[model samples]
Target: MGKFDDLPETRRKGLEKMEEVYGFDMSDGEGDFFRYTADHLFADIWNRPGLSNRDRRLFLIGMLVGQRANDVLGIQVPAALKNGELDEDALRELVILACHYDGWPNGSRMNAVVEDAIGKAKRAAGS
Candidate 1:
C-alpha cells in the first residue's frame, strides 16, 4: 500500500494548508523526535486507514483532553477546525469528557480554550 506521499493531490494540498493554518514546522527543530513528529504526525499517523480526517481529529482531541493539554488547545483546537475536521459540539464534548479524566478544573480551562478556538475559526471564516 502507498504511504502518505501516495495520497491524492488535493489531500497533499490539505496537508500543506494545515502547516500554514496551524503554524507547524514540518521540518524538525534539530531533534530526532521532533523530526519524527513533523514528518509522520500527519504524513503517516494522520494518513491511516479506515478513519476519516474528522475521526483523526476526534481521536486527537480525546488524547489532548485526557492529557490535560488545555494550554496548547488554544492553538490545536483551532487548528483542527481549520483542517475541516472538528465542529463546535464535538469540540465541546472533548472538553466535557476531559472532566471525567483530567478533572473539572482542567476541563473548565479546556472549555474556555475550545470556545476561543471556535470563535477564532468562525471569525476567520467570516461567519
Candidate 2:
C-alpha cells in the first residue's frame, strides 16, 4: 500500500476533515511523525466506526483537561464549537465535570482556554 492506500478514500476524506476542522498540515513539516499523523492518526483512528466526531471532541476535551494540554485545547475547543460539535453551555458543563475528576486547578486552567477558544470561534463566526 502507498502512503494512505490502506484506507484509500477514507484516508483522503479524513485528511480533508482534519484540514477543515483543525487546519492541520501534515506536509508542512519534515518528519515521519506528520505522515503517521495523517495516515494513521487522522485517517485510521479518526475514521474508526464507533464514535462520532462530537464524541471524539468530548473525549478529547476531557483528556486535555485532565492532562492540562492547553495548547491542543486552544485548537480543538474552538473547532468543536465552530463545527457545531459543542455549544457554550455544554462546553461549560463538560469542563465542570472534568473539574470534579481532575481537580479545581485543571478545570480553572482549561476554562481559560475554553473562554479563549470560544472568543476566537465567535470572532471567526463574526458574531
Candidate 3:
C-alpha cells in the first residue's frame, strides 16, 4: 500500500482540500510537518466555512507581504492564479493595497513576485 493509504479521514480530506486550493496533488507529501499541514492547517483551518477560499487567500497575501514572506508568496500567488481565486488585475491591486499598509520595500518585492507568477501562470496556460 502507499505510504498515505492508512491516513485518517481528516488527513484524506486535508489532502483533497490542499489539492483543490493549490491546483496540484498533495498526497505525496511526507513527514510530520506535511502531516500537520494537511491535517491541521488544510483540513481543519482552511475547511472552515466562515470565509471563501478567495477571502482567505487575500488575507494570506496581505499577511505574507507584511511578513516579507516572498518565498511562500511565490508558491501561493501562483496557486491563487491557477485556482482562479484571483486574477492578474486583482493581484496587482492587492500588491498596491497590501504594500500601502505593509511598506514600499515589501510592496516592490511582492510586485516582482506577482509579476513572475503571472508570467509563469500565463505560460503554463498557453495564454
Give the number of the best model, judged by TM-score. Answer: 3
lDDT string, candidate 1, 38-90, tens digits: 45665566666898766666676677777767666666788777766677887
Number of residue pairs clashing in candidate 3, backbone atoms closer than 3 angstroms, sequence gap of 3 or more or interchain: 0
Model 1, residue 102: displacement in angstroms?
4.0
The TM-score values for the models, in the order shown, are 0.65, 0.80, 0.89
Candidate 2's C-alpha runs over 4 A off are 1-11, 23-30
List the candidate numbers ranked by lDDT, top first: 3, 2, 1
Instruction: In angstroms, give how far residue 22 of model 3 lies from its true place.
Output: 0.8
For model 3, name the residue pairs that clash.
none
lDDT of each: 0.68, 0.77, 0.88
Regions of model 1 farther than 4 Å from truth: 1-31
Model 1: worst 10 consecutive residues (lDDT sum): 21-30
Highest lDDT: which candidate?
A: 3
